[model samples]
Target chain A: MKKHHLRIPGPTEVPEQVLRAMQAPMINHRGEEFTSLFKKVSEEIKEVFQTKNDVLVFPSAGTGAMEAAIANLFSPGDLIVSFSCGVFGDRFADIAEAFGARVERIKVEWGRPVTYEIVRERISKDTKKEIKGVLFTHNETSTGVLNDIKSLREAVGDHPALVIVDAISSLGAVELNTDEWQIDVVVAGSQKALMIPPGLGLVSVSERAWKAVEDSKMPKYYWNFKNAKKSLEKGETPYTPAVSLVYALEESLKQIFDEGLENIIMRHKLLAKALREGLKNLGFRLFAQDSWASPTVTAVDISDFQGKINFSKALKNRFNITVAGGQEKLKGKIIRIGHVGYVDELDIINVLSAIEMILADEELFGKGVKAAEKVFNEGVEV
Target chain B: MKKHHLRIPGPTEVPEQVLRAMQAPMINHRGEEFTSLFKKVSEEIKEVFQTKNDVLVFPSAGTGAMEAAIANLFSPGDLIVSFSCGVFGDRFADIAEAFGARVERIKVEWGRPVTYEIVRERISKDTKKEIKGVLFTHNETSTGVLNDIKSLREAVGDHPALVIVDAISSLGAVELNTDEWQIDVVVAGSQKALMIPPGLGLVSVSERAWKAVEDSKMPKYYWNFKNAKKSLEKGETPYTPAVSLVYALEESLKQIFDEGLENIIMRHKLLAKALREGLKNLGFRLFAQDSWASPTVTAVDISDFQGKINFSKALKNRFNITVAGGQEKLKGKIIRIGHVGYVDELDIINVLSAIEMILADEELFGKGVKAAEKVFNEGVEV
Candidate 1:
């Protein structure tokens, strides 16, 4: 049996320490032991989110956090501008539509980020300020594109509408100043960049979002923001949280703070560049343009293989590197290599060397690895 | 440092093998490895539920699963009969009400089960068949009462309204025949008798529940049963599940099947009875009537102490055993001792001995322990 390499967009490689922390015997969630830990985590996660507002933790997947953003902030028939470019972006829009919101979808091309002007133009057209909110996916992992949310927020231009960002795959490994950007809500999860498994869905709420939440009439229970906030006041969650995951989060937040956010961000950026540059050097075309390419995941157009090799299968079966296939319309057309969370430059080099081995004909033995090493050498300050 | 004993109702003591399994590295959730594991767990969980129906595994706490049932089965203003006996029962009713259901709550007194006559009387009044569903908490751990669900189902008596049971704290430790009892939905959690940490909300859905899910007008995304069912068809989840918890569950379920469900139930019953008798021998009064006493958690009236000792604090401060105090109306009136998941005869004995030490009056030194030993010796056929 070969050793496995997890390179999926999420459910990424959890740190060894975090896993050990999770294995610590269960504790009473309602007691002081959990409350003290909860308060500390509640305080520390704010640094990662770069927000002073409350961060609501839920025992759910990242998509569930995105749904919480929709459920809490707006009522049915509210006008919401949904920015769509990738699978997760569409999923957010779908959740909004399901809640009976009038979603004016600004459809961006796959593998492309939505420009500030596009958001400004849409908000400008809502003459009466009828639009209640805008949903944005900061990082579209499916298409390996990261939207410039700080610029997009500026595009709203003093509109009373709330601004929500789905930063599930981007928050920790990327630079997201939630308060500085004036983001009303930022949704994230444990799987990506948090260096833990996928259970805890962390959503940050600004004063602006809470104001909207006060009057929203959506039928809700499990994701009710007010109930969660009340419990947090006592350092408790409204319901039973995933206790083991929270333990993992405490240790993970420690590791994240230890690394320092800026260095972590740089490490992700350099690793992504190494992977993309290495793949490009091997004649594989990159899916997203270099300008808006995600710092976490990179997509490679599968046409370069000429159907001679199933990249995902070969990587898994032979190399033991579990890269991802594209989703929805991009299925079978591209391969997505994720370098989020606990991934390092060496992991990228290992993947590249294996890819070279799989696609070797002649003169390609060390081409990809050489290109990756060059990028890592020229870059990577931390 | 004193050794810690987690004795809360849930987030119970996870077994060593399960903890070891969770420490295994994360894997690609979309890959064959996870899919095979998903299929295996899905199939095995039905045995635990004793149902032939599809069990939708959600990455959430027990309350979240209750929310799923309410969101998927009934629309706004749908009539639902909620039977409330304790905190969790009231919580189930609150969830229904939050979803805009016209909840007709049958309030059974705390420390007592909802009698079959009460259920029959409630259903008998709904001659128009307007009652869409009846929510039942099979075990009211908050009050240490176990409602007889099989008899209660007979009270429903061919009524078309769906019967949903919250078997969160009772399922793995008690006998529950979901299909045989004709329950439309059964909600459970990982932390209780499953011998794993919290994070997973396991729900079994009958064919009838699926039909209601199709026609229900409630808006849902994260807890959408249809989406979960579709993903299960391909041996995947609608979103990234708590992958590590599922690993724990796979191992835990293996241990559960090896122990046999009947044997597990007997172990729980004996432990609860031994603990109750031991406490009673020391002049402590069990809150619930002996007839309906829960086989998981037991509530002892605080009055038994004559206000001489703080039982919960003393237990923790001295022995490091974390027992829960009462909730809401019962707060300061009772002490809840959780004897669920991974508990055996010795755990009960240790707790009894600690209580005896805390209330040592020389004459009471080994009274509780002796009474507990007598119960264990005579009982515990398994």
Candidate 2:
């Protein structure tokens, strides 16, 4: 009875209730029942986003949402500021560039967050106000770094540049006040902290972003924000949506609401703390700086280990545990352990023990477990 | 014990086996297991497409695939001929126009298929041969009309126009030989005849379309076929896929293959015949002409009925049966009964009886049942 434990940064474990909810029979997307379901789900999603802005749902992965943001809010030759600290941040910039945006990318080190000082400096230097938008990632999944969105928005101060955030791996697990931070657009995916499968891409649009959409001349049909908004007014999508995922999202949202959003965020923070302490005790170096480490995923440096590639394979083969390896330039140098949706302390403990067992080192295993327990015992007071 | 019947044109009845398959635990999409699954599903999809060309799967609705075809296969200001007979057909043209294509629309009356003569006339008139592609729908779900692709392709004889088809609701339930018909691109969705929920958009691109892609200047990121094809060669998708839907698709494909493609098409034909006969006996007229009526969805004229709005409401409220109504200009004038996906003869009989009951006419019910039974008794033989 060996159960596989999934600890990927995204596509984390989904609860059985959510899976069962998705198993329900199909419903007509254009019908009364589905309209009500659609409305309810939209409302719930907005609640999670902590915004009164329109939340548009698309039958796509997070990258699609990122593209939608660029295509809908900017026209050809529009200048934009894109901050890149990791792979996902770079991807956000790439989407903008693909749509003909002249992007001035602010590159930061892989394991560091995009500092507010750099953002302030960039926006201040743009006295001409040629930049139409600022594209950044709330949480860099590849590096497990979380940028300070509120501080970045504050730095943009009174500027017309829309703040478009890729909150794919962070939204539900972290404290993101969309409206308070004045983010023009926030792009997210279902397979991350939402505790659902990959298919649906959720985006929250502010009135300012809607204005940008109106003036935008970028060629788009499927990802057109106006069509989505119009259909959403009628409680339907412009195109057919991924119905099963919506059902699963309903169940997942129910679980989220029951636990409360604030508590969920706190739980994630505590879990990350425990996992980081465990890794530290096991003599593993943390990938990201402590100040901006993402609560959703923890990256541990494995470059010093002799069998880096073999380590992930042995963990899966021996204990049926799945963790993610570093992507791009950091490949084979780090392992990412996701503590996102549907994950709890027991799951974390199981993963820690499995890693220790794979190492076959008693002293490290004892110290790691003790460190994790100390963190867990303190409890998530928030 | 009231089991609701889903008879909409899409979001059709999914099989229990497929639903169960979707309930499986999440697997790493970038891992060996998912790579194997992805390859197997791609090959099976090609079998259903009836083509040796590449079949690209996107985690989006059918409209996304339509957008993909336009974005990848044509540059801005590229001349294209789009034949519009119904809502979906017009939508195809809209996508092309949105991408800056100068489309020559061959508009036919609603509920009628675009004839080969009209296509030939349009193509022959373009003596300059400036038209890069000819876009048409295989099955227009809005009006229950199925155009003749083979005839249309033959009409474009020695021309350089690429034959792009929207086969969202007809591919599996109709006889469409992609290679034999020389189709350049075919776009389809999962929820119609594919017996799955709404999420995946499957597009098959011939060698000709690939050439068009190389020269296309339209900007694309999310729906870029080149990136998708590149990743597919490595047994992966450029972006994360809706993994659960792929699992469900595998199960759905097994059911399709087990029953046989030819037999499935025959079943749809026979079921459609039964449904049309039943509607006819009940003093109703078919919306589409009999010669080119779609076998997947049967549209019945409801303009003369005083209780047009109440009809669908009564069907759902009283019988728990869901069917589709017409769109655009035909709304509240026609009701569409979908026999696509997992629907059978018994399901059709139940719907017919429910319609009769809603009318409160015993004589109509008896005649309808008899007409349906006569066709069902004949049995489908491929």
TM-score of each: 0.52, 0.52
What's chain A's TM-score in each predicted model? 0.98, 0.98
Instruction: List all candidate RMSDs to the true structure.
Output: 26.2, 26.1
Candidate-wise lDDT, in order: 0.87, 0.86
List runs of model 1 lying over 4 Å from the truth: B1-382
Supply candidate 1's per-residue lDDT for B300: 93
**Looking at the true structure's interface, with contacts defined as alpha carbon pairs within 8 Å between chains A and B, what fraction does model 1 recover?**
0.00
Candidate 1 Cα deviation (angstroms), residue B156: 88
Q: Write model 2 residue lDDT over B1-382, tens digit each, in one string.
A: 1236798999898887888889888999999988899999998999899999999999999999999999999999999889989998999999999999998888999988898899999889889989899998999999999999899889899899888999999988899999988999999999998999999999999998999999999989999999999999887999999999999999999999998999888889988998888789889999987789999999999888855446788778755689888898888888899999887755666576567656664344235645665666555631
Fnat of each prediction, in sequence: 0.00, 0.00
